[model samples]
Target: MDANGGIEIERKFDVDELAVLPPLIDLPGVQAIAEPVVHDLEAVYFDTNDLVLSAARITLRRRTGGDDAGWHLKLPQNAGRRREIHAPLGRDRQGEADAVPESLAQLVRVYVRAAPLVPVARLTTIRVVHALIGAGGETLAVLCDDRVQAERLVHEPASAAWREWEFELVDAPEDLLDAGQAVLAVAGILVSGHASKLARALGDRLTAESPRNRQRPTPTGPAGNVLLASLGEQIGVIRAQDPRIRQHTLGSVHAMRVALRRLRSVLATYRSLVDPTVVQHLRTELGWLAAVLGGSRDEEVLQRRLAGLLDREDPAVLLGSIRDRLTTRSAADAATARHTLVVALDSHRYFRLLDALDALAASPPFTATAGQDARVVVPALVTKEWKKLRRAVRRATGTVPGPERDLALHEVRKRAKRLRYAAETAHPLNPKRAARVSGFAQKLQTILGDQHDSVIARERLLRRGGVDAYLRGENTFSYGRLHALEQQKAADAEALFWKAWSHRP
Candidate 1:
């Protein structure tokens, strides 16, 4: 079935049994309220027994008895908004209760991994919906009064009941929501502290304080603390980008790729603070992921650069079908690369990799050095990477401009990236110094990145047989001119890098 998805922006307020809703029509920008429509919504929320999805504030449910009933996955977004993805409810080949629908399950795979999903809570809500309309008869927002009866289905069956009001924006300004809140305050309805219905339904199981919450303060002397925190941050990024990557959102693939790179860099840079065997294994797996994501990222970068360059070219020198050819090639390549990414994401190896990451975060293999002060150990690591970058830059600039120089510069770029990541991990402890180092490293990385792009673009242009200009009886001279221009740009970047290196702190 074709999927439907959108961002759901709404606010929920707890209402006492005796409270009455204030006039929504009088709210700013609301001219009228439509007749209330009632919906009896029966939803069974699914999650792993451990409630991983719920902890992350994601909800997946198969609902019936509503106008828009199906399997819905709600991913938490910023500021009381959710990105909801919906799939039509249907039985699997074996005729089960939709079997979580592959479309929705894949989105949460990063959280649940190989764990089995089961019904965690069953909720029956009687909803009275009012449409607040604008003067132009457009729906400004929706007001839903929900009477909820929730039963926890896992571990032990228990039940609870509540009434809440949801004010959801449709085509209204945010100020309208603020106005509605102010009006509701007069009637004593206040925003609920609970994040979601599932959180309220599961009660203490979902909200209970873990032992980690009660642990003593973080050790100030532990390099392991800094390294683990850095690893955790990247893991969070990887998980956050997983759903977006599955949806093929622009820049999601690159974000996930960068997260993997940073994770690998931290593991390598802090190998002395962790078990070598485990770190090596993680590094290998991360390399695999990076390689899988690189194809699409490279193509995406090349397509953007070529398009921008073509846009700036004079019409007189523009050749036949060049834009069309590039577009077609880029689209085809992207489609294939995206397919590869999806397959990788669905593979058993990928699932195991996620499990490994969770395991690492929960219990890292810290060595004796891990207990040392980050202030002492981290700067040494950053300095080591900086030295590596300096050597690579020196070798690259001393060489004549050619394929050899390009290769050397590429190495410099890689070292600069590692140095930047190391500096980032150290930034939490010493912000000013780390910021300066990171800034310098970023400048060098950008310059070398451009040179690398030019190298790749020239190779790609050559592979395309000079842009097919002969088809329109036009000379391919423009292609040669573009190639030479890219070369000059690379040379210019190299010279700039040398100048910057002379004054390097």
Candidate 2:
């Protein structure tokens, strides 16, 4: 099962008091409809006093009397789609019901922070479910008719009742939905205006302080506009990855790290357009966040590379317990890294950083040069980064292939990354030229990145000291061989970097 949750593709419709569902078996791609199954479900929803989760279009509830009864969290994905995560309902201190699972609660920490969560609504639903089957007997979709009664539990209790129909896709194509909609329209049914039952139950209480309503206006002038746009784009990335990182989704940490780097690069590259002191402070915080995330990212990369190398080697040459050792180390590192990340997320500093980012987006402190044309200002910034890369590369190639030269090349790699980010920022103005520069910088970055990986691998191998091999009754010859090979690969990467630089644009 996906830790982040499963994607749900479904649509809802409001029905009149006497309305009935149209024949779904005859819909396109649906061969038959199974007998209806009735379920009586009661759910209690939890949220902050201010309805933070509802405003974000998220819902968390504990449901009883269902086939998959447990805790369910639904997060909005796109129009008519949601990602649903589930957890078991274990016992609490009184042996009644447990509080929210730590795993699930952590995912929402970005929204609730230190706020207390309480029961906001309770709902009882009587649902009739019919499965739409294809010719091959595969379940393609499900049609549900629901009668719902909801009671607001907090801040002046109230009760309401309603009926609705929901058509949800299983493995069927989208055309089936169009057919279903056509049939429903003929029966005088229309899509529901509210996003969910919870939304309708809350009514006007679910204030309009949504992120969409809080978006900043477009800044004027070329420089300010470009800088603001890039900052806003990266800020969105950071926010989107927060829950994914909490869920421990694959590659989420690396993606969040890259977004932080891009945001920091924009601050540095367009410093003249914003307040210098504020940009410096933000850059420092971004650097700290990136370093925290990099811990696990580096371990993940090394484990993959070493495992791949071991897999391709001859069985006779393969040393004892190499794979097991790598696995143990990787697991330990990942646990520690994730703990560090969770601690940071739960801190006041992280919340303040998020607030600072929002403020920067909404009302940036623009300098005198912010009103200039981007075509004129952006090119100069790109040129400056390119020059920095050239100087670093020259210094790297000037030294012999050793630790000094390796360090120099690492500096070159950092410069290349900055230049690539700058070129990407300039893409909106001159796409063709920016593409050339970005492509060239990426090639350099890739070569040096491999070189750095080899360095890290060799250091790890040396630290191992053949303890696992000795315990497994094998010699340490393979470890020495691997180290020698990595050293040679690092040298080859350095050579490749110079060769690629000769054709730099």
Candidate 3:
């Protein structure tokens, strides 16, 4: 059997109802039971040298328990989602107690700070399971009554806490929670305060992992060598989200996109730190990934914006089948776009790109900028970014306020964003100056962001113009309207850009 199960939904609730006055009386066919048996569980968790699992907010444990128990590796599958893998007892969840599993440890190889996985903490849970099934006999909820004991890292003295819950799941028509809640309400049972007993027990320890501290030392020797350390972190994020995105495990696409953008942004920001040729190669691949995913995101944004616009207008002035037409075409486009993203992810090129990036991160080819110590080097970096912004503003000012001007300003906006991120990364050394540069870069980016959104909206319409005519039986009138609005926004952005640019030092 597969050790890993796909994403599982786990929820918890309080048992105060039966504990307090007026015990659960509802349920025409059911009788009430006061006491139930609970068993104590003990588990020690481990992670790789870099704490990959923890950095990804995943927890792995080896536990001795009540009914269903074994070595468990719980990996994150998006917000409030997790994939639990079970292995036979006596061995570490990853393989051995002292050493990390090669397969799992490979994932964190880039940040191998510590030598081996160590005992982080121990958790003991007293669990009670209640069967809530219907006459046709399907389980609706598993009411679990729990009391927990926790010990800090390396088998320190233990701590204890008591709690109870009803874990609701989907096996019936209505929400299992509603029926269970209705019964528990009469008994004065309230939902659990913490999301999970483990979460509550860990307290501050849950928030211990930080990526920066986990980073491997910058490979060194000579000056002018640029380190792409940040890119490795970004790639790690992308890989971590891949399986979740495949599962459509909520917010996966957005998270993946953010990771890609951060990697691309790092390339753009630290152009002087690393090899431009390599950066260019990486950017092209990143652009392809972004474009593949951008279609769905763009349509999502347009549908939302257009619907908001139509909502404010008189229903009569809406003209044509705007909502239906957009929805029909958008759904088709979204499906195609999703397929493209999946295929691209599976391609050999993508893997090659990842391999290349990992190599670069490990031993970056830094330029002259890398030679200077962070203290002497950072301000000059800030100044270089300021210069780029100044050049963009200059190019944009002389041009007439139109499509050409909009495009130019958008380019400037891109530069500003790159500078802002670079400044943020350098902020540890010179907090005050870095903050000022970041703030100004942000204002410039905002102006450009509005303009760029308009530009993309127009590009999307042009691409969809033909498809809209064939499917919706129209010449893309709605798209045209959106394009016009976007152009106007671009015009408006020119005024805003100049106003914002003038304020920057």
Candidate 4:
């Protein structure tokens, strides 16, 4: 699925400008080498004046003359790999600064906010491609030797020329990248110091403008550093999920909401390390975003779960328009919810929230405790979360099976989740038994989450199936049966939660 969006898993090397090429078809996993093909490609890269995309290891460009020439957005996926998205050149063939494809722009909206994406660099490449074929005549990889002319789009617009070799995997395993790198390394070729063409093209100008290289104040204490790093990771996850959500990718909305919750949980758990007012504001905004995503996600979940339940039910009990009402109403509700979610995602308010989050990641407001030794302070924070979880669990278990208990169990699930996140953040330098607590919290969380889902399902069946279908004169027998099943599922989940909690570490 990750590769469905054209993930580029490749390795690159900088070869001497006039260096002779190495032997053609001798690398590992190569059965034959296809005839060489040449392409003269011209590209223009875009970014803010401050090089926001470049700083984040992202590149957006419009190119012509290549077989796949169009608008390309290359985003960092992992080490030595990028998720490349391609869209038509559309109206920006002449390289209009503000004419970036809206589809691509939305993916980077969190970064560029209101900033214009102007031409930052231009590249013209004379690329000779050699395809390395593997078992069963599969094209394992493409090797390109590119002689390039790059011009920095600045006040003076400096130009540089160089030649480099690119080995990109097609139908090859990740080990192929390392294998090819080894083959190239033996021939006096090393990995390129520059990360990409845009990075190389910008030259020292990139270093001068990129915020990543700029010096900052003294580093925070260990505990503060750990918390901030966790926060940054969650922020990265949210940003990465943005395009997936826009594309209606399954589980993206839920993944994004989880990231938001983790971010808020970190701030709340480590409140003593940061300024109260600022942390509170960030948490409020994160909650707002999560709620907005939850609306669409909950609807979709209900519809899907009900559909699955219907599939397993006996045909004899299925009566009236119950399935139709469920399908029709849920579909409409999910669509409306999705529309609202998209609007919220594109709103100025959401952009401002993103800005706040970025600011928080860049430089957080720290209190005196932030300077303390993490060994002494971090344990207490995790302990606090655990204690809260214990209290919630006790209250929830003591309550009778009713709405109040359902609410209490939900509270327990939230607390357990917070503990799980805090312990995970502290897992790296763990000394406070974080692993044990995290294991217990994770199991408890899963059990309780199932119960909460059943709670929601029951309510949905009552409202959508019971009342709505009743008003329409459709027999409500199926709704009653489904509702009873949901009730039993909730009871069974609660029993599992208590049994698991008893032996929790």
**How do the candidates rank by lDDT, highest first?**
4, 1, 2, 3
lDDT of 3 at 351: 68
lDDT of 4 by residue, 23-114 (tens): 64677788888999999999999999888788788999988986887888888887768989888767857765448888898888777877
Worst 10 residues of 1 by lDDT: 208-217
Best by TM-score: 4
**TM value for model 1:** 0.88
Give per-residue CA lDDT, model 3, range 1-505, as digits (tens): 1354445555666653247323333443234433456777777767553344565566666677766566666666665666665655644576655444444443333333234666666677777766555555555435666666676553233565666764545344335456566666666676666655555555554554334324332223222322344565577787777665665666777787877776787677667778889889988988778776676566666656656655765665545676676567767777887788767766667667776766676667778777666565555666777788788778877877667776678788878887887776665556777798888888878877777777766675566653655475764665566657767877788678778777775
Residue ranges of candidate 4 with Cα displaced over 4 Å: 1-5, 29-32, 92-98, 133-138, 174-179, 208-221
Mark the regions of model 1 whose C-alpha exceeds 4 Å error after superposition.
1-5, 23-26, 94-97, 182-186, 207-221, 308-331, 397-400, 464-481
Worst 10 residues of 2 by lDDT: 212-221
Please give the lDDT score for candidate 4.
0.85
lDDT of 1 at 50: 89
By TM-score, the candidates rank as 4, 1, 2, 3
Clashes of 3: 7
User: Per-residue lDDT of 344-380 in model 2, one digit per residue for the tens?
Assistant: 8788888888888878987888897877877788889
Better of 2 and 4 by lDDT: 4
